[model samples]
Target: MQLHSSGVQYKLHLCLSVTLELILKILELKLMVVIMIKDWNVMDLVCTCVTTLLLVLICLLLYFISVYPENCGSYHGPHSINCLITIWEEVGCKIKGLRYPGVLTNADANTLKIMNLRNVKANMESVKSAADGGNADQQLNCYGIAIPNTCDSHNGPHSVECLTSIWESKGCLSEGTKAPVKLNTAEKEALALLNLE
Candidate 1:
């Protein structure tokens, strides 16, 4: 009876040992998986950082390229001033034909008042002509303080006032404010000879 009891005790000990070993193995597996996930996260972060840096670099490069004087192409000349004038004149022409929402529109009234303040009637006329001629390039030059297409519509009195205020602030018809009517350069020689300080 003593021998039999001892043998049973030995078997119970063996079973406990086996269970402990199994638990250890499972724990090791879980640790390995956790380590692998951490590694993957690190790699993902590194890739994202690289991509962001590359995008920033690309944007900076594009900005520099756009502003470089050498990239101005055939428009490089002292007559650039004259060219600008011509472009604005063309755009003024186009704006003339645009249909306003109402003859007694607040936008029209505001535009008239602003124009009177700036004495911008001539410039506006030129811009209208350019727009009417379907000269897209000229129209682009007429931007910055000029009446946008939205102004032709009667949005409201607030919009009209806002637009007029912006135009006025740009020195449109103010005395002693000379409107730019000429291109800075007329030809390659003029550009090369220009003393841009």
Candidate 2:
């Protein structure tokens, strides 16, 4: 996915700076209220404290209302300020819409396509017939040659399981070429980029 421009980061920083300034001002105001109440009786002190706290709450509410849209996007669902803050910290800005489950990256989407093709090929009538008969070796070789080529044709990297399937289907196991349960660093990284790890 294309990343948003640096304006997002700039706005985030601006919001944070504004929030910090507000907090400092609120602290100063609280200190002033406490200091200005020198001769206040117990009830007066209680009322002053309550009024100061309500003012602070109102200021914070207004501050959140001002920044919520820029930071939280158009999500209408119930959400906490803490959730918005967490999204800002983790993802730079609002996600823009409802984040459905099982969100996939581009590579992951391609891998899933390849996987669907592989599944169809593996479950074909010819392969089923070969399995039923004594032509398993022939079928295996055909798939071993076809599957990897199909994956490459789609420009998708193979996972460890795909590599192992290819190796075994090519009769490498019978020829004493042990199948690998893991791939090398570069191959693993390629698969990881597709989220097939």
Candidate 3:
């Protein structure tokens, strides 16, 4: 009876050891699953942050493009004003024998200094209109020119001449250049037809 009791106790110890090992393995598996889930959550958060940053950058780029002077079709900022002045200077140099009415003629220089002072005034007026929350029409009126209906109206040197003529007709003359009343009969008739007198 003593031997039989000893064998029974040995079997019980073996069974308890097996059950403990299985419990330890199950706990280790649960821990691994928790760690994987945490890693996945971190990766998801990083992806979301990157995506959000990219979206914000794209939106800012679009806003800048929309408000850019070239894109908006007029001088809306300091850069635009500078660009217009540069263009005016270039155009002034190119046109020969065409005197800017009211501007002082410097015959000493090879390039005629036909500075469009009106453009500076027009730029200031545009800035004021923008500050006043005026619409596009008001902005154009402030600039003393009509907005072109088509994009093509803003094309080439001819457009500049046309724009200058309009400003001249409105009595915005240069300071020292004499105004010549050399309009031909055809021109007078045309002006009459347009009621521009």
Candidate 4:
């Protein structure tokens, strides 16, 4: 069996517990409704009313907690909540379209989950293959133009630092004869390719 982190286990346990509590509360409400309809006694009515009010308060609190979770603060809260609600609405629509939809179905969820796992596996394999190839030299080509290096470095000839050295070689430097000189074609092309233009 796959091992889960403590945090994940805790969250799953809490969710199941909450769902069970909500289900029991719903059953209790239904029973209370039936009792109230059968007997119109003052005491029974008051007790039923109090129970229903409490149940409503609990459900409302649960709704808020579900919509605005702790991690909601890390994201755009209202936008995230709207996105979640939209997804839930789509699921609700699917449920309504089912032939004999008495139970919630995870057919779509399971399919999408399997697809996501396959995609992740594919990506991991590709990353592993690239790592196996060893660190090859990355020759930077800027817009069909090659930037020549005047000084040697690990980043090869196309690096901006190496390009600066090339510029200095061409008398483009401070306290020199051509201090504030314009860039040559190669330097300009390199900058353009590097998106520093």
Best by lDDT: 2
lDDT, candidate 1, 1-197, per-residue tens? 01212344555556556555655655565557558775666555555655655565555444333321221122223223223333333333322233211222565434443332123335555554564354544444333223345333212222433343434566564232232222232432343342211
Clash tally, candidates in order? 36, 0, 7, 0
lDDT of 2 at 187: 56
Per-residue lDDT over 1-197 for candidate 4, one digit per residue giving the tens place of the 0 to 100 score:
12323455565566657766765766677577677775546446656666776676566545434332222221222223223223333322212222111222455333323333334224334432332233221111111112244333222324445556555766677455323235566655555354211
| Arranged by TM-score, best first | 2, 1, 4, 3
Top candidate when judged by TM-score against the true structure? 2
What are the TM-scores, per candidate, against the unseen true structure?
0.22, 0.26, 0.20, 0.22
**CA lDDT of 158 in candidate 1?**
26
Candidate 1 regions exceeding 4 Å error are 1-38, 67-79, 83-197
TM-score of 3: 0.20
> What does the lDDT come to for candidate 3?
0.38
Instruction: Give the alpha carbon lDDT tens digit for every residue of 1-197 in model 2.
Output: 12233465565566667666765666676567668865446446656655666676666544444333233332332433333334322432112212211233555334333433223223333443442244534334222223333233212355556655556766777344344454567755555345111
User: Pairs clashing in candidate 3?
Assistant: 101-174, 102-174, 102-175, 102-176, 102-177, 103-174, 103-175
Backbone steric clashes in candidate 1, count: 36
What residue runs in model 3 are displaced by over 4 Å at the alpha carbon? 1-35, 38-40, 52-82, 85-197
Angstrom error at residue 45, model 2: 14
Alpha-carbon lDDT, every model: 0.39, 0.42, 0.38, 0.40
